[model samples]
Target: MAKYKQLFLMGLLLAIVSCEQPSPPATAEAGKVAFNITSYLQQQRQMLETRQPMVLKSVATQGQEPEVVETPDIDWEDELAVFEQADLSRPSLQEFYTRQEQVLEDGSTAIEFTKLEGANPQVQYLRLVMSPEGKLKQLHARLEDKNIIFFSRRTINLSTNPQTGDIADYHVEGVQKMVLGDTLRYEVKANL
Candidate 1:
C-alpha cells in the first residue's frame, strides 16, 4: 500500500511536467500564439507560432485552365507597384496578391499590418502573416475590439534583408507592434 501511494505521487509529478500545454498555435486572424514554433525562431520579445516558405505551386482542377502558379521574375528596380490598397488582412487573398512578387524572397515571407477592417471601416484588426510555400500559411492578430482608436492608430511594417551581393532571394522579418498597446512582434532567422 505504501508503494502504491509513492507510485501515484511520482505519476502525478510526471504529469505536471509532461502535460504542460504547448504554446497556442498562431492564427491568421491575429498575431498571437500560446507556444513557440521553433527554438531558432524564438525571440525574447516574441515567439513564432508558425513559419511558412514561399513557393508558387500549380493548381489542378477539372473544367478549368491549368493554373500554373508562377511568381513573376521581376527586376528589383523595374517592377512598378501593381497593387493599390493591397492589404494583408486576409491570409489567402493577400498571398494571392503578393504572388506577383516584385522580387523573390527567401524560402518564406513574413509581413505585418495594422488598421485592418472587415468590409466596414468601423471594424479594425491587426495580423502578422507568414507564408511557407507548399506547406502552410499562417497569421496572428491581437485580442482587439472594434470602435476603438487603437485599431486605427497602430503602425505595422514589413521589410526584407537581402544577402550582400545577392538580391534574387533573401530573408524577411517584420513586426506589427503597437506602441503602448499589445505589441505583436514577428521575426525569423534561417541559415543559408
Candidate 2:
C-alpha cells in the first residue's frame, strides 16, 4: 500500500509539470536594425569634437540675403541633431519603412529607406551612399510634419570626405507654414 501511494504521488507531480504553460517565443523582429543611424551620428559627433574643424556656414531666408560665417566655435551636436531625427532604427519604427540596397556604377553602395503606404512617419525618405570600403560618402533625408495649425518640411543632404571619413559639407532646406502667419522658407549650408 505504501509503495502504491509513492507511485501515485510521483505520477501526480509529473502530470502537474507537464501541464505547465510553455514560455513565449523570443522577439526576433524587434532586434532587426535596418541601419544604426543613431550610433553612426554619435561616432561622427565624437570625431568632430576631437577635430574642432572650422565651418563656413551660410543661412538664407525668404526675401533676405544669405548670411555667411566662418567659425571654429559652434555646437556640433546641435548642428547634427537634424540628421539624427531621421534615424529609423527605433524598435517602434521597424515596420514603418522599407529598405532597398544597390551597388552604383562607381563601386559605391546606395541604401534607401522609404516610408510604407498608410504609415505616417516623420522621415518620408532616407538614402545613404557608402564607398567600396563601406565608408559613408553621402546621406540624404526628407522629413515632414503637419498638424491642424502648422506644416513643416525639411530636406537634408550631407557629404563626407572619402579619404578621411569626415563631413565635408551639408545642406538643410525647409519650409514652414502657419495657419495665420506668412509662409517661411529657409536654407542653411555649411562647409567644413
Candidate 3:
C-alpha cells in the first residue's frame, strides 16, 4: 500500500511539471514559405537607380483631372514603398494567412495569400503570377485600415516585363474617409 501511494505521488508530480513547461517560440518554416516582396522591391529599386528608367506618372485626387508627367528623376524608393506593405513574411503573420498555388491555363503559375476569416491583417489579399520561365509577370494586393476616426482602402496592381523582370506599369487607387469629413478618392499610375 505504501509503494502504491509513492507511485501515485510521483506520477502526479510528473504530470504537473510537464503541464508547466513553456512552449517553443513560433517560427517561419525554412525555405520560401511566402514570396519575399521586400527583397524583390529592393532589387527593383537598385536596378532602377542604376538604369534610371523613364517613367510616365499620372496622379488624380478628389475627382479632379489626372495630371500626367514624364520624367526620369522620380524617387524610386518612395514610389515603390507602398507595395512593401503586402509582405507576409513576419513570424507573427505566419498562421494568419492561407496560401494557395495554381497553374494558369496560359502556362503561368499563380500564387496567392489571403487573410483568414477573423484575422485583422491590413493586407487582405495578395496575388502573384509568374511566367513559364519563372519570371514575375503580375502582382495585385488589397489593403485596408479602419478605426474610429479614419478609414482607408487601397488596391495596387503591377505588371512586369517577364523577360527582363522589369516593372512595366503599376497602378494604385484608393479611397479615404474621416469622421465628420468628406470622403476623398485618389489614383496614381506609373508606366516605366
TM-score, cand. 3: 0.80
Report, for every candidate in turn, its global Cα lDDT versus the true structure: 0.32, 0.88, 0.88
Candidate 2, 92-148: lDDT as tens digits: 785787778899999998988889999988999999898898788999999999999
Q: Which whole-number lDDT from 0 to 100 does residue 63 have in model 2? A: 94
Q: Residue 42, candidate 3: how far off, in angstroms? A: 0.5
lDDT accuracy of residue 3 in candidate 3: 100
Using Cα atoms with residue i matched to residue i, what is each candidate's TM-score against the true structure?
0.19, 0.80, 0.80
Residue 34 in candidate 3 has what lDDT?
A: 69
- Model 3: lDDT equals 0.88
**Candidate 2 segments whose C-alpha is farther than 4 A from its true place:** 1-32
Worst 10 residues of 3 by lDDT: 23-32
